[model samples]
Target: MMMNKEQEKLPLPLLFRQEANESLLAFCRESARDLPWRRSVTPYRVWISEIMLQQTRAEVVRRYYDRFLAELPTPRALAEASDDRLAKLWEGLGYYRRASLMKRAACVIVEKHGGELPRDYASLRALPGFGDYTAAAVASFAYGLRAAAVDGNLLRVLARLFRVEENVLSSKTAKTLREIAYRMLPDAKDGTSGGERYLYDGYAAAEWNQAMMELGAQICLPNTQPKCEKCPLSAYCIACAEGCAERLPIRESTLKRKEEARTVLRVTDGERYLLHRRAEKGLLAGLFEFPNKEGTLSEDEAKKAVEEMGFSVKSLRALAPARHVFTHLTWHLSGYEVTVPPIDRAALPEDFFAPTKEELYRDYSIPGAFGAYKP
Candidate 1:
């Protein structure tokens, strides 16, 4: 591959690269946490864990991972799971679309791949919700393939190590960083001599990838808060020597979150509460939620809103205000509890249902965004 002037200046010295690799691997061997996914490494387990880890904290994914696996242990099982059951299993995860796409991919796997995750990166990338990073992760971690899983963590680590000044989020910088990661793999060619140069291979490749990620997550952190003193790669990090590790990996664009107001209603008839299923597309799709509308409503307006849905309001009381933030949206919520007489089930909207308190908690997948308002 041809190198631009910037790329030419980015390559580390060969001896330093070798020492850095050994230091990183040793650090991982000694200090790596016993994460569940690392314990029992399977293609299916890796796939599930990677998906759950996206835009979610590893600590948070821990709560859902084991439960999700216990219920749907195999691709075939996940392929056959009902929508409601799947949604319930993924209730607190927030991104419902990932669950939906996983089901679609599972169905394809069961039909086309004999109920096993495909071992090749290309085939895995073709599956729903699988991207370059995910495909590479599964290939390297699960199948011992020589693929580099270049996630944000790895990107930051690389940028700091080489003192890259470009925006790490750009495609060009990402591609260059990925190439550097690939070259650092065990038994990878150094791109110079004709002779085959072998450093390490097989499971060692997986260990190297995980070690890089662990370093970034725990020591070489982002947001001007890197713990360079504890980082294994600090000795060789160009950014560390320059006293700018925190500012090395620049991001060009910062997304502005759109704010919105919502009025949530906890309409109940002493025993059962009203729930509505969101449309099958868009944000929070297909999940059960407390009946809510787009904007804060006055107490009288809240009562009128309930009546418009064909309900008789016996009493109305305001509940505490709540807020939930998504990736690019913020919901400022106001809530109300409305007591009503028992209504005719047959007259309710097809998309609406009234479930007893016990049933609501046990069966429905009410998102945590409305947790503050749930009775």
Candidate 2:
């Protein structure tokens, strides 16, 4: 097909218009990782995997994905899942709000969508926690729709390929990059006229999107270490041609992570440990945590704090200090192991309770941030 002068002048790169897409698809066919999420290929599975992959490494997500699916296999199951069960399944993954939002979305799916993920882009996007990227991913990878699932990997790949010098983190830059990705779709040349037809041979929309993501993840790596020699798109990559692939995708964000000091109390009565349920809102919301206070407290202060909770502290020993980094905050933690005499359950604080070791490990969902202090 011949392009008009106006179309020719568009920012859509020749790489996306010609052989680069084919090269990327072929590379993925030969070299894509045998990820577990790639096996089932259901809307529910795809939705879960994409949500889990957010702000998490694929390797780490693998450990939880299968187990989570085994327990809550469908939208109805997820919507009906108990808070304890949900928290336990999602423990250590961080970003607890994702799990909560997923549950809310599952309820909506069960009630409104007939216990299935919606098949269209706009409907999927309307679901709770379903951002444009996630909605696009489910629409394309699961439903085989012509939606562009442009994530960080694709953003990096496109930025380097087009040698974009603007701050890639900005919304304008990301939107532009996403538009370019949409144009690279197989039937995008004909706009909406082709419907679900694939213009490219032996390549589905799912494969194309996954291939682009895989190339970025495996070859066009972030920082200063992109493996240009192994990149299938290297021949057409403007950044590679200019010897500036490493610096092409600029990110000039000004946000800084706030630091916080915390003192964690691992108060135990020999066999049972004290756990507190966080409030139903805010960070780590509705998850279990060790009784902790703001600011690093000395051993004496920790003992006093525990006693103030109406527990008679029998013995106190200092535990090693630990730190946990969240997306926007860093927790510098000091801890104490306080041994207390067994007390009546009624005497415990409203949101505090002591559970046996087995119960704590099996029933409670302790955040990883309290790992160093958990009994």
Candidate 3:
């Protein structure tokens, strides 16, 4: 790959100024996907969609966006929703914390912002789950403000466009890219109408920001080699010119995920499975799960463990083992089917509730980590 010493030292924004902006917006106007969130533009819609899009892809988010809005149409609805309903709607999205935070943020908006999202960046950032990327997204896309929202996609595009050698995952590198995005915004801001609908003339700040993100998602993909020949900004892309577009956005090596062995207890009578509501603070908070204990156990050990929990185990059979991966950890799960006498709700531990198969299907919300063992 060829190297340009001077280009490596130049700021990303200055390297691809107006020429890159026009190419990106023009490409987007012709090639942007017809996403659900883009069709109905609103501060609330953008807020929910952006939060959902974090660490998740657009295609996956498509399945949930409209349904979530259909159920919780307003901030008040979301704030007042039952935990089961919210979790059920957001089931399979993988990150339960995002759903939890969205509920909290809705309450804040209802109580403090008068049931509407604040139009300013500072106020939006103050809301739960609205980080720099999400806040700037709401400000620029929903409000037509000249704010730059730099996300992973946009970061890759900028990093490759200017051949940045800095680690893109670092906070300092993120701030630098955000500055570049701010500089790349369209020169004029038309401002929002302070309502739920918006229409841009293809060169507005919102369009520009979306265009950059779209280009990154469609052309400058992260996992594979970028389609530079089809990219509108290829002419000005330093990485393309240097034949190293695939290697520009450098990231520090990630730590290995810690492995855990777990034995999932599926204690059942004829009516319902023994379930418990997790603590309201840590991982999988407020979600339902079958009774489980750490470490894989033998059939005799499993029966003994359940008896220790104050239940008489009748029979035990080992089921298949499954694995679930989180961002920092992986759970190697061994499941067991244990038969027991009918549970007495009064005798069960606090916060433990057994739901019948029908009720579990229709009402409860279990985390994806327990999917393999879920009946």
Candidate 4:
């Protein structure tokens, strides 16, 4: 908790979190961002929304959030679900590890905490996928405990408001931000619960956290491109006066993806396409996909593989080539949507799969953002 001479010299009133909270709340009540998760607040619901929002847009999150809730229903249901099922649920949502770790977290609640999400900050932080932002979000939003949820949105807001220039990727940024937030807390103020002080002021905490995040996501925005005209806190924001809001939340750099060539096999038997469920662990794990090999395969080899699978390749035609980038790898993809004469029904391998045209829409979750789906 030691602050350097420079940090200690900063005026204490400048660190007031409640003032920032009030500014944001005033903005939100007058112009709250409409989101589904905002409707009902629960530990589990808020936790899922937090995970889905990581590196994903609010619109895209809205789609996944509803589907995920409908399918899993509860923590116990998610905990017991197979990795394949979980991965399938999270299909097309990159960063599959988030889904995996979330399932692991649910399992821990069942085994260690008797199916209840522990309310303590430390306990939530120890969960498999919980980072500081996520941990703080769960604490504030769900439990009503005052904490800072410093995601990208919050970081941008803080950086612009404070005019901080530190690289946000650095751990130093996280530490400084958290320290600032700590100074801002309302000193454990007493509040009513059913006309009595049951204390642990959660309602105020929830409003405070949500308002900060909402302001950041909608108004403060990345750099100076912020919609200053529509912003409610324009009068108070430091970046607004300086006109350097966009330049505030500086980041280090994004890792370069290694380019890899892949040939996706689009083997088909006239009406249905061949597919398989990939193995668990490593890239697109458990999502259904056509057989593929790194780099282009010789037509002879591709023909041989198809024949071995008990299908006669009638013709091979090239579809539009596509590309999909992941954190570590870039798939420079080429697909050959081949037509195969119907193979013997019983001869198909156990893991081998075929999807009717309608089934493509039903069964598998292809990453369409990456490339066009072909059968």
Q: Count clashing pairs, candidate 2.
A: 0
279 Cα displacement, candidate 4 (Å): 2.4
Q: What is the descending lDDT order?
A: 2, 1, 3, 4
lDDT values of the candidates? Answer: 0.84, 0.84, 0.82, 0.73
Error of 4 at 55 (Å): 2.3
Q: Regarding TM-score, does 2 or 3 come out ahead?
A: 2
What is the per-residue lDDT of model 1 for residues 1-375, given as tens digits with 9 covering 90 to 100? Answer: 123467546654445446677777777767887788888889999999999998788999999999999999999999999999998999888777888999999999999999999988889989998887898889888887877788998898889888899998888888988878876765433221233222223465676778888898889888889999998888888899999887779888667899999999999998999999989887888888899989999998999999998888999999999999987899999999999999667778899999888999899988878989888
lDDT of 2 by residue, 1-375 (tens): 112355445566575644666677778777888889988788999999999999899999999999999999999999999988999999978888899999999999999999999888889999999987999889888877877888888899999988999998899998888877777776534322323333232336676888887887789889998999998888888899999998768988767999999999998989899999999888888889999999999888898899899999999998999999987899999999999998567778799878899999989999889988877
The lDDT of model 2 is 0.84
Q: Per-residue CA lDDT of candidate 3, range 115-172, in tens? A: 9999888898899988888888888888877677888889899898878999988888
Candidate 2 versus the native: TM-score? 0.92
The best candidate by TM-score is 2
lDDT of 1 at 285: 84
Looking at candidate 3, what is the lDDT of residue 180? 67
Instruction: List the pairs of residues colliding in candidate 3.
Output: none
Clash count of each predicted structure: 3, 0, 0, 5
TM-score each candidate: 0.90, 0.92, 0.90, 0.85
- Runs off by more than 4 Å, candidate 4: 1-15, 187-202, 296-310, 367-371
Worst 10 residues of 3 by lDDT: 189-198
